[model samples]
Target: MNRYDNERLSAIAVLESLRAGVPTRASTKALPDLRPNLLEIFKEDLKIFAGGQNLPGKFVWGKYGQGKTHVLASIEHLALDMGFAVSRVSLSREVSCHNLFHFYSKVAVPLRTPNSTVFGLQRLINQKTEYELLNSPIQNEGRYVHPLPALIFEDYFRTEGEEQDTLYGYLMGNPPSDFKSLHKKARGEKPILKLERKFKPSEHATAF
Candidate 1:
């Protein structure tokens, strides 16, 4: 197929996947050029993130059919290209903003990275070194202690055996009730329960 035809087919496939309630593999290439203003804003925000600066969250607000999802997918693709991990979650009744635990779980479930488009968190946990993973938390305890992302990292690296399964269960909204029990089962006494228990139920319920 010609380039245009190929792009058309790719867009169709993405729409089909969305209709099927499956994750779409849409990339920035599939999207038309964003408006110049939007593009500039995206670049500026991306530069901040790439520079290791904390940028406040930007919300995309539009009615249905205004290309919100497409814009988000494009941003996600660009973030991955820029070596940043991305996760996209659509809020529904089941994963509502009113319910923090469910929302957090949904966000973790769809995390994507440059290499892995789905289940990227698992890949990250397995690939990142213990020192690499623990360095920031060790250096700056305030930033990484009780945040949702920190909880995820702590739970995944809490014990050695079946780490992936434990994280998967947490992302799936079925966190362990007791980290002490989990550590005992793994035959490791690392003392993560205190930190784990410090999190609010909305924060650590899935992985606690």
Candidate 2:
């Protein structure tokens, strides 16, 4: 097949994946030439995200076979390349936007990061745990007393064995019941709590 035929076949394959309710592989390149205007709009939104600016919400509307899924898959590929974690969930009767809980659950089910195509949440927690271990002190005096590493594990171990559970709850649109307690457990120090609370809710929420 020539280059044009290959691209056409690739696009068709992506559409088939979408139809089958599977995410396009991260290695799949977006055929922006198929929808130049939509791709340009996605690029602009990505620029705003990369620059650490607040991006306004976008609503994409199109009929069947109008390349909506293709546009979305293209955006996902670009977002991952730009170091942003992304999740794509189709809105339907079971995962309606009107229901926050169900919607969050659906979104969490498909979470993806640049390095992960599946089980992204588990990978995220594992990586963070590794980071904490690496940053933890080896010396006797500083091992337990260091505030940073203690705080890290505290969050990881907060609520006894419910650390992962708590994380799941948070990702599914339920903030932990006691942020204060979680913070204290993570830090194990009274002095640092005051400094931590100074951060705004938005800042604190994005710490992950």
Candidate 3:
């Protein structure tokens, strides 16, 4: 659906509205308003990711509260709606080895893929999660038996931070299984994009 000017937004729009948990009582199905510039950026993204197209390494950065998280959430919902694997997180807490390593194990959404690999997603901008869930085992004739590819997407970024290079490095290469294990055996890791240091100091500490 042409979000710029349409009778109604497409399933993507509906998914985004839902992810945001916003109420859109105006219609039986809620959707996001394209708002011109927003629609243009989305269209550009589509063009870049078209079938057989080669997309260069790119980072999406915007001022705080400028809908970056919303856009990623919408994309994730869109992926899920398309029968793709998806896992997600919100880096609103402290970042520990446990926080970095717990990229998988979300299981699955109630209505979709019981055996599909978890979707790795996070809401912390410019942070890094040490390990990625990679792929997960799927069911064969009787039970989940094979591994399926898991797609990773990011919500926000800190642009240039201490973990910035390390975070991007983790996304491009293979990650060890014990990558900063909570137990810290020094042997475990997974590869994927993530948020870092976002969950430090604590939110209530600044109220003084």
Candidate 4:
């Protein structure tokens, strides 16, 4: 279909989402801005983040039934359109951000990039070579306090099927398993993975 056709369909979808009281990316994008100043602030933050600078976290506070979630949905769509990955999650009894790794797990699995409908970064990671990953910013630039995540990420590329799935799940804050055994399955001939340091839950909460 043409560009106009796509926009027309998206508009319809946005209307439906709004009608249901569920604000989505499409609705966020097509509708008129409710708070342009706040949006500009978020846009500037996103621009800086895209430039590889660390941005302090933002808090959105509101009373019940306010449009806080709706604003976040708008930001999600805006970030996606800017070629940034987005993950929008809600807190509930089952999910709490009090535990950093637990929060990481919740966000990691739902990762959404600008170009793909599929969730997670597996496809993107699968496209990279060892050399590329080894020298990548997350690994070499001191993004995380612990190397465990980068190591598991490296191994994720090495293994296949269930092993790979497990590694991905491990990153997503699932229960720990015999990673050594799992690594052996992936790299039988290679030496077992070694930790440069122990992973302490309290200290390593922000590793994601």
Q: lDDT per model, in order? A: 0.63, 0.61, 0.37, 0.81
In terms of TM-score, which candidate is stronger, 2 or 4? 4
lDDT of 4 by residue, 8-105 (tens): 78887888898787897767867799899998999999999989898899898899878887888888889999999888787896678787777788
Better of 2 and 3 by TM-score: 2
Q: What is the lDDT of candidate 2?
A: 0.61
Q: Report the number of clashing residue pairs per model.
A: 1, 2, 28, 0
Q: After superposition, how far is residue 100 of candidate 4 from its true place, in Å?
A: 1.3
**Clash pairs of candidate 4?**
none
Q: Which runs in model 2 stand beyond 4 Å of their true positions?
A: 1-23, 26-32, 92-105, 130-155, 158-208
Task: Indicate whether candidate 2 or candidate 4 has the larger lDDT.
Answer: 4
Whose lDDT is greatest here? 4
Name the weakest run of 10 consecutive residues (lDDT summed) in model 3.
147-156
Write model 1 residue lDDT over 159-192, tens digit each, in one string. Answer: 6657647755764565667645664544455554
Winner by TM-score: 4
Q: How accurate locally is residue 165 in candidate 3, as Cα lDDT from 0 to 100?
A: 36
Model 3 bad stretches (over 4 Å): 1-29, 32-59, 92-101, 106-208
Better of 1 and 4 by lDDT: 4
lDDT of 4 at 6: 77
Q: What is the lDDT ranking, best to worst? A: 4, 1, 2, 3
